[model samples]
Target: MKAVETAPHEYMANYVYSNSGLGAWFGAARLVDATGSKRGSFRLNGETWRVTLSYQESGLAPPEGGETPDGTRVDFDTLREFRLNAVVDDEIGERKVKALIQPRWYGLESESGKSVARPMWELGDAVNVRVNASNVEFDTVETAIQRAAGAVTLDPMYFDDRNEEYSVVMDAARYVRLDRDVSGPVHAREGPIARMGHLLESDRSGYRKIVQDDTERVGYYHTVTLGPKRVRECFPDHRIPKEFKHYYARNAESLPDDHPLAHPKVEASYQGSRWDETLRPVDHDELADELEEAVLATINEAGLPTQPLDDDGLGGGRTYVEDAYFEAKTVDRSRVLPLNLERVESDQRNVVVRQLANGLSPVEWDSLKTLVADGGDVSPAEIADEHDWHPDSVRRGLRRIEDMVVREQGSVALRSHYVAEQVVEALDAAREGVRNAMGTAANAVQNAERRSLDERTDELIAFCQSNGIHIDEREAQLRVRMGNLTGESWSELVTRLKRFWTAAGRDPERLKESVTHYRDEAGPKIRQARGAWTGGQTLQ
Candidate 1:
């Protein structure tokens, strides 16, 4: 065999390991020197190595596949010439070597005219694996590294003035990638893979290291013995989002069949119970409901990055959020309350109490009590009318009972008018306590709010009075300010706005009800704008 091709530097020591659990991982394998000053290190991702070399009694021995016969004294010169090319630090036989690397260790080059080092372990230490970092903190930097993933071409539209264009050294492997919420003057540590350690062929000009004598021999021997390997490695990193690892194997029907994420080939292999259930198709109507729910949840969750959508936060990224008709739909997940109150009383063994509400007279109370005792039941509406209490209050009181039962699954249920009445009484007590607290709280809150309101109103009124707003400046000067309200504040804002319109000689009510360019759709439009205003973007 050709000497250089089959040239092997047998390891002075051996490391043996095996996995009984059906798996073993070889992260990175490189034969490097002891002190890490020189190297013969080679990247061996998963490959095995075979080396044959002999320590000659001679001044210098070529590094190749040749076994040693114990006839020669360990010629330290020829012996130490074989360097480890596939290692990080210098090792003596089996001693561990410390390895420290920065992010830029991958981009170093050899100095020109540097002879290809045949020195063993010493050479591995001499190998250059430098990564030039332009200050990791982005200080004095208006422009920083950028990595654009999935883009076929670059666009400089976002840049304005002085330094506009961004350059990437393709040979240096300097690249930019997009990160979530990245915009405007970003700091260092913003770029992908901020720092790393390095090891290169000896001739390559790169980082230098201090090499001790003993380390030199050991490093040289190691490099000549083992080889090199290229493999992926874990590193200390800036925080990365879970979405970066979207393996996409959920029953998230939110992703359409045509979407890449939904394609069968794209999903990560998952064999959970949910996966088994996902295959069983529901009836058409049931499937429709499920699909609708999935869509609503997908859309709702898209606007909220904080709360996870499901166990797998891999479903999707955020989108603008807006909804038109927000009707309060009743969701009775459990049928806790039967239609009649008789079951409640019956269920409670008739110990359940009864009470009259809605202005029931003494006569009516007696009659209603007798009726309930005789196994009769009445709707909340009926009791409200009988007691002259507003049906709404009756309903609300009844709802408290309903809520308790529903919330606790019978941990506590209002079984009768007596039970419902007790619940209402407790609620009233709490409400009264709150009211008492409000009496004290009211002054402080009112004073603070008044001060704030005065300032805001003064600012708005002064600006409007100073400017030609709401009324003609040449005519009567006017100032408009909002007042404390007994009704909806938003509706009051409209009312005040109407007064402004009237002062300006326009129809007040019509203007308040106007569905013009920026009036009717303003609320939803503003909400949409707020949703879309990601980092560095604003409403304007």
Candidate 2:
């Protein structure tokens, strides 16, 4: 029988080809300076960077018994995997490195389930294949390593660019801001995500520090890592055939009749992305859904990068993966939202409180109250145990109020001291039967004010038009609002606008929306001053 390979790629592509935009991820093993010695330097992208060496000895024995025809011993008792990691910092930047890279070898197959030892010559061939498949200069990196380390065989190391984490380096220049509807542009802070600090009894290893380092400004990329063992424990209802583990282990043999992949429909789905197969045929959807759930559950799980790093944001380089989608020619850059850290303002906090009061169920309110009263750092399990509620129920309640909370080290807390105060105030008001009334009244007042502004803006536009001056509505509103905010006399503001149109080489007789665009392009400080048009009722 011909050796058959499993079509995991087809299933895997479903994840990569989904509707979601590619987020940055650090997918490589955390840089462990295992050897604690820096190798010689090399240049990359026209910058000099130092390389470090590390070797991890895998306890798992190498494939045994198979040997070359010449009778050299094939199996080794232990396998030592070497690693080379490199980093170069941004210019004059305090810490966050501009590029963190692990050299990759091209000519080697994945070391997934090889049952036999590879020939000794393949390592040299692999090195010759190039690091990152770049030009001759990069290839010299191998020669430099050979000269420094002396007779080291390069293992087939592969780095997937799509797995890199995006750390938005904070500096004086690229400060983040949010353009507001009412107040103006406000500065923001990026906080890291909380992660489980300890190991799970069932897991082998973990990356706790990396998970906790992920922040709103930093994208934490994750891929599906759940395999057969954990999947069976969590999702016993699904039809994950017992033979699934060994499916990839065997290269060419046809799957057993009882295996899910052995089914005709499952095989057909493998041929293309359009999986026409029904769920009942192989329970694929059920398995996929359960696997996805398990993946999410692993966010702070042990054996993954879920621990908080204690390095004070200075030491170490992160794994970076640039997504394959970014390389495509047809990407719509316009639709991409700028990824920036944003500060939640008092108004925003008020809005969230109002939304929560109006939207939360009684149980959600209870959860919020409990969180506030518990010193704001309790675990979800403790909250569930406190109320004797099912964990899912507790989670559902908390999810409804998640906007006002920040999670850290496997515990939850109100987002800030302000949020805590707001929660307490809201809770007190609720007891008095007026919790929602204040929020509602406030919203109503704001709406009325906006409506009044709209009416005045229309009157101002008409007033200007009658005076033989032409302007777009937005432009007119901005100018009037600018005048009001600045306390500029109405006449001086009008003269400035007329001059703006004249300077732009546009006649007042031919009004264009371009004036509004011009006003927006005037930059943040100018735009901030123009949100609400107010002042003299009569054209001055």
Candidate 3:
């Protein structure tokens, strides 16, 4: 038997008209022509009955084929069949039904421009009676129910005979259900699939929407077959069984394009994607070991010096790899061999020498030397402008050179006659003086100690008065340093005072040690004078 496709509307129309009332029983009876047997026997309601079916030609051609315009010839035919069968099942009892079968037709045109008819019996519908009877009319509700029941009994056979048509309807229903259950949730989760749906809805071509709809329909069919639970299990909130995680991941990957879950957008959002990234097993220790081995091999090949291990065969607390890594990072390339600055080129040597001699930073000396080399007799302002230095800084550097000249040449009046060589020598002398001053200041601060608050205050007053230093700034500095000093000897304070005078460009070396001695020893004499004024009793 052949199977055919039948639209639901057409199938229903045929079922209602051919299988209504007594027509349903006759609909299953096979019609006989003169060339075949005219009678057949079938069991109905557990009773045997004989029936005859005959086709009466109406002598009419099916509506005259429209005139084949342009000499186009088309042939068409519709064929129908009826069969009766009985079903004996222990559960439902015996039942008999007649089935009405019809072939669905499609038109074909031959290469010769002649129209051909192709009859598809597989693309057809079968309607069956519901009751077990030879001849019965379904007029009342009870009888109609009985007839429907008999028809259902015959469905399995009918479906087997018309499997293609049955499959078509079943597949469509399955798709609709899948779209509602599976695709809906998937589309909600997956951005890309949702976008695709929107695109389909907005598409003007109609063709694209049709294609997308078909794809979705097919996807739904496959999803149904795979079972919706497989897809749902892989969702983030679902607790997939440990053994089933891999299975679910595989299923998710294998979903067809019609399924929104299978869409790239949707797949990217699945928990499986994250699981694939992080849950995969890794041998971290093995990788670390391999890396260590590779590094040790490279170090040995390069003949690099490694940190020595102790007699216990351990490199301190670190592994061989760690020590090697440290050595690799900290090894001094410059100290690998001695570097003689004297043997360097004259230009490079000059850069180094100028930096040290002028006490200028490398950047500052480079800028200054570049300017002087380019323009002889550069002004302090011009040097400051060229080097982005403050005018005061440039002037101070010039004054230091002048001071150096006075100190070295033993002539304060010979500053105007200084030559370039003398200027360089002066800068060097100034640099040495600044270094010595900084060293002395650091020593004084380090050695300074604190005295009792009252003692420090008296000492500050005496020092200010004796030096005639009326500067509030110096007085403030002395007070601050004295308050901070703790247990320092008087000599430390003297050194601090000497530094303070030296910073004022004065020679403090000539100050008598009697100055501090007078302050320290005068404490007793002053107290005695106060006691005498208070009438000899020791004043508090």
Winning candidate number (lDDT): 2
Assess each prediction's global lDDT (C-alpha) against the native.
Answer: 0.22, 0.31, 0.27
* Candidate no. 2 TM-score: 0.26
Give per-residue CA lDDT, model 1, range 63-124, as digits (tens): 22332221212222232222111221222221111111110011112223233322221212
Candidate ordering by lDDT (highest first)? 2, 3, 1
Best by TM-score: 2
lDDT tens readout by residue for model 2, 1-540: 111111111121100101111111111122232334335444545655444555454333332253323333324344334444433334422211112222112122234643222343222111111122111121133343333232122221221112212111111010000011110101111111111111101122211121221222222221122223322333344323111110111221254533422211101111111122222212343433332233222321212221112235331232111111111111111121111111122233433434442456766676777787886478778877777777788777776665566555667766554456556666665676654443532333233311012233333333433333333222233222331223443345555565554443334443221222212222322232222243313222
Q: Write the per-residue lDDT of candidate 3 for residues 1-540, one digit (tens) a residue.
A: 110111110001022111122233223333232324243444444544333333332222221262222222324242224333332333432222332332222232343444333354222122322222211211111232333324433222233221222221000000001112223333331222222222122112221111122243322321111111222212222221111000022243477645433432111111222122221112222222222222222222223222234444444432122110012122211112111111111222222222233344433443335333543344556667777788667666545434221222211211111122223443344446644322222222223331111233234334533442222121112111222223553445445565554443333333321122223322421112212123333222
lDDT of 3 at 438: 25
- Error (Å) of candidate 1 at residue 173 is 47
Model 3 C-alpha lDDT versus the unseen true structure: 0.27
